[model samples]
Target: MSDRAEAAVRVIEGSLRKRGRLRDSHITLAHGSGGKAMRDLIEDVFVGSFDNPALAALEDQAVVALSELASHGDRLAFTTDTFVVNPLFFPGGDIGTLAVAGTVNDLAVSGAKPLFLSCGIVMEEGLPVEALRRVVASMKRTAEQAGVYIVTGDTKVVERGAADKLFINTAGIGVVPEGISISARNARPGDAVIVSGYLGDHGTAILVARNELALETQIASDCQPLNGLVETMLRACPDLHCLRDATRGGVATVLNEFAQSSGVTIRVREAALPLRQEVKGACEILGLDPLYLANEGKLVAVVPAEAAQRVLAAMRAHPAGEHAAVIGEVTGEQAGVVVLQTVFGGERIIDMLVGEQLPRIC
Candidate 1:
C-alpha cells in the first residue's frame, strides 16, 4: 500500500486506543480486506454500535420466528429498501432511521402491519466506529416506534476508497390485514385525495443538510414511520380506494402513478395543498418545487367522498398526521396524467420526475 493507504490504516487502528469508545478518525482501505482489519472494524464499529440480541447472534443470517403463521394464516407482505444518502446524518434522521422508516412505510402503504425487519449494512473501513454506533442505535429506536423487531442482520466492510462511509439495506415482512385491500390501481374518479401531512419538508431538509448549507430558517426532515397513522385510517375508512407513500419521486410522481394505474386524472388544488412555511421558502430559494421533493413519512390516500371526513379525522388523531388535509380530487379526463389547479383557476400538468433532483437521497 502507498503511504496514504498506510496512513489511513493507522488512523483506523488508532481509534481503538480504549474499549467501548471509538476516538474520531477516518476510514482506510485495509479495514475491508477480510482479515484482522475487517474483524476489528466489525467488532469495534458495527457490533459495538448495534449491540442487540439479533445482531449479537453474529450469524450469517438472522433467524426469526413467525408466530403469525399460526394465527393470521399464510398471507404475508414483504418489502425491502436500500438507503445511500450522501450525508449519513441529516437534519431529522440518519440513514439508519430512513432504512427503518422506508421499510415500515412500504408495508403500511401496502395495507400490511409490519412485524419484523432484517438489516444489512455495508461500511467503509476508515469510518469512525462511533458514527456507526449512532446510526445503529437510531435504527433500533425507529423500529421500536413502529412496533417491529430487528430479528436478523448482516454487516460487511468494504475498502475505504471503494465505498461511501456507510450504506444500509433493510427488508421487512408484515401481515396483510383481512378486508383491507389497497393498490395504486384502485383509485377512481370522484374519490377525494387526502395527504397525511405536510409535503416537501423531508426532501428540502435533506437537500439543505447534504449541501452543508443552511437556510434562513432551520429546517428538519419529516422522516418517520406511518404504521400507526395508517392503521387508524384503515379502521375509519375501510373502503379506502388506494394508498401510496411519497418517497423519492415525490407527490407528483405518486399522483402520476395513481392516474395511470387507476385510469383516472388527479386534480390537486394548489391552495388546499399543505406546504410548511419554512419548506416553501427553502424550495423557493433553492429553485426546487416542493411537489417533486422526496418525503419519508407522509402518505396519500384516495377514498370515497363520503368517508373523507372520517378518514381525515382518524389521520389527524395520530401525531404523525397532525397536518393531514384533503388536497385534491380524482377526475375522469386525462387519464394517466396529474393536473394541478392553480389559485388563479388555471391548471398545469404534474408529470413524473424526469431525472433525479437529488441523487442518493434515500
Candidate 2:
C-alpha cells in the first residue's frame, strides 16, 4: 500500500477503536424522525465511524478549498451510483463495500484520483442495527484503503416492506491530472486492449449467494477500489487512450462502447480472456456469458501498442490487478463492432445485450 493509503487506514482503525460501540440493536422509525434518535444514530454510526474534518463539521455540504483541489490535478471527475443488490451481504462483500468501491472505481476508470465521497443510505425500519453497523464498517475500511474520505452523507428510514433491507447511494469526486485525456473516443487502431483481472466473479458470486442456482462453487465477488492500480498504470503509460471499469454491463459492454465511440473494430481473443475456474463453471451451468457478466473491480484499458508491455507489467504488480491480461486490439475494419475470435480460430460479433440479462447484480 502507498503511504497515503496506509495513513488513512490507520486513522480509520484508530477512530473505530476510540468510539466504543453503537447502542442500537435494530433500526426503528424513530431513528429517521429527525429527533434525538436520529441524532444518536448519525453520531454513533456514520459520523463516529467516518471521522474526517469535513464530515466532523456536520454541515449540509462539505466545503473544500480550491487550492487543495487544484493541487491534485487540472480537472475534476464526478460520478454517482446506487447499490440495491438482492442479497445485501454477499460472499466476499456487502452493500457498503460495494457502494464505496463502485463509486471510487467509476472515478478511477475516468483517470482520476478519487478524493471524497457522499453516502446516502435508506434503511428499512425493522432492519437490524448490527447489519447496518457491519455495512458502515466495511465502507470505512474500503474508503481508507482507497485513500478517500466520506465527507458528507444522509440517512432515511422507511417502514418495513418498503425497502428490501438496505439501499446505499454514493457520489464521489476525483481529480484528473493534466495532459491525461482518456475516453472511449480516444481509442485508435493499433492500440492494445487490456483487462485488469478476471471477469464475471462478481456477477456469478451474486447469483450463487442468492441460491438461484443450486451449483455450489466458491466464487467470491471481485469488489475493490481500483484507483491505486490505475495510478500505477498511468505512471508506466501516461499516454493511455481509454480506461473504463467493467461494471454493470461487464467487459463486453465496455468494449462495445469503445468501438462505437472511437468508430473502430475491437478484436478480442477468447484464449486471452481471463477467467476464474469457479466463475467459468458457474457461467456454464447457468447459461451465462462471462463477457456480459458484471465486474466491480476489473477494468478495460486501451493504450498504444508500443506501451502495452509496460502497462501490463504495472498492472500485474498491483494487488488488485494481479490477473491482468492483454486480451485484444483495435482495428480499422468493421467500425463500431466488437469481434471475438474463438479459441478454435473462428470469429463472431459480440454485440451489446438488447435487454437486461442480470439485473441488480451490481
Candidate 3:
C-alpha cells in the first residue's frame, strides 16, 4: 500500500481505540477469561467485523429460522473443517479464508447452497491484535463472496508455547435443492470426469510460501470460494453425479473416493490434467506428483456423457473455472480403481497417499 493508504488506516484504527474500544495491542490469556477483556475482544474484533443481525444478537447459539432454510431446499448439508496452515497469511489467502472457504466448498460440492457458518478460534498468547482483526476481516469478506453468513463463533486463548500463532475451525450449514442428489457413490460408468481449473496451486503456494525449498516463484494459492462456480455448473448440469473440491489428497484422492464408493473405475489422462508451469516445476524439483497435490479453488465433477460438454462450457464461462477441462471418464472394467493415462503413453495407477505428502495444509 502507499504511504497515504497506510496513514489512513492508522488514523481510522486510532480513532477506534481512542473511543475506549479494543484497547489492547496484543492478546493475552485474559482475553479468554470471560471477563471484560474477553468481551472487548469478542465485541470489537469478531462480532464487530462479522456484522450481521444473527451474530449481533450475541446469544450462546445462533437461531436461524426454519422457513428460511426450507425456502432454498429440502435437506440440510452440514460440514465442519479446521484450518491450521503454518503461516497466518499467504499469497492469495490466509487461515481465515481457508476456514470459511473449506467449509463452504464442502457444502457446495454436495449440491447445497451454503447459508451460515460458525467460527471457533484458538489464539496463542502474545499474538498481535491486528492479526486477529485482519483474519476476522478476511473471514467476513470470504463469507460474503460465498453468499453466506458468519452467524456465531467462539474464541479462546492459549499459552504462547501451547499453540501455534492461530488456529481456526469453521462449521457450515447449507440447503440442498430438491431433486439434486450428488454423492461420491453417484458416479457411474461412462460418466465424464471434469476439473474446474489449474491443479496443485494451493499446495504449491504453501510450499513456496515457506521458502523451505529456497525456490523463488510467483505462485499464489488458488483459494477462492468455489460456491459460485458450483452453482454455475449446476445450472448447466442439474444431474451432476459426483462432486468434490479436492483438498488434502488433491484430485487423485477425491477420484479414488468416488471410484471406491460407486464401485467403478475412474480413468484420467495425465496430459489432460491442468497445471501451472510453476507447479509442474516445483513438483519435479520435489520429486512429487502434481496429481496428488492439493487445490483450494478447484473442483472435480462427474457428469453424464451427454451433458459433459455443456457443463464444461458453463464452467469455463465462469471466472472460477476458466481452465476447466474434462480429464477422463468412468469405466466398469476395474472397480474401485483410478487409472491415469500418462503423457508418455503409459497407464499408471493413482492411489491414495500412504502418509502425509505435506502437513499443516488447510
Per-candidate TM vs. native? Answer: 0.87, 0.93, 0.94
Query: Which stretches in model 2 have alpha-carbon errors above 4 Å?
Result: 1-22
Q: Which pairs clash in model 3?
A: none
Give the per-residue lDDT of model 2 (tens digit) for 1-362.
99999999978865664465556788999998887678678888888899999988888999999799999999999999999998989988999999999999999988899999999989998899989989999999999999999999989999999998999999999999998899999999999999999999899989989888788788899999999999999999989998999988889999999999999999999999999988888888888899999998899999999999999999999999999999999999977999999999999999986699788897
Name the best candidate (by TM-score): 3
Residue-wise C-alpha lDDT for candidate 3, range 1-362, written one tens digit per residue: 99999999978865575345687899999999987678778888887788888988889899988999999999999999989998789888999998999999999999999999999999999999999888889998999999899999988999988999999999999999999999999998999999999999999999988876668989999998999999999999899999999999999999999999999999999999999898999999999898889898899999999999999999999999999999999999887999999989999899987699999978
Off by over 4 Å in 3: 1-20
Model 1, 1-362: lDDT tens per residue? 99999999878765553244433465555555666555565666666555567665667676656774435435689889999987899889989899999999999998888888888788887788668778988987898899888777666778757788899999998888677788999988799999988898878877787664466557788899999999899899877888989999999889999999999999999899899998888877778888898999999999999999999999998999999999999989877989999989999999999977988889
Better of 1 and 3 by TM-score: 3
Clashing pairs in 1: 26-126, 27-126, 27-127, 28-126
Which 10 consecutive residues of model 1 have the lowest summed lDDT? Answer: 15-24
Q: Report backbone clashes per prediction.
A: 4, 0, 0
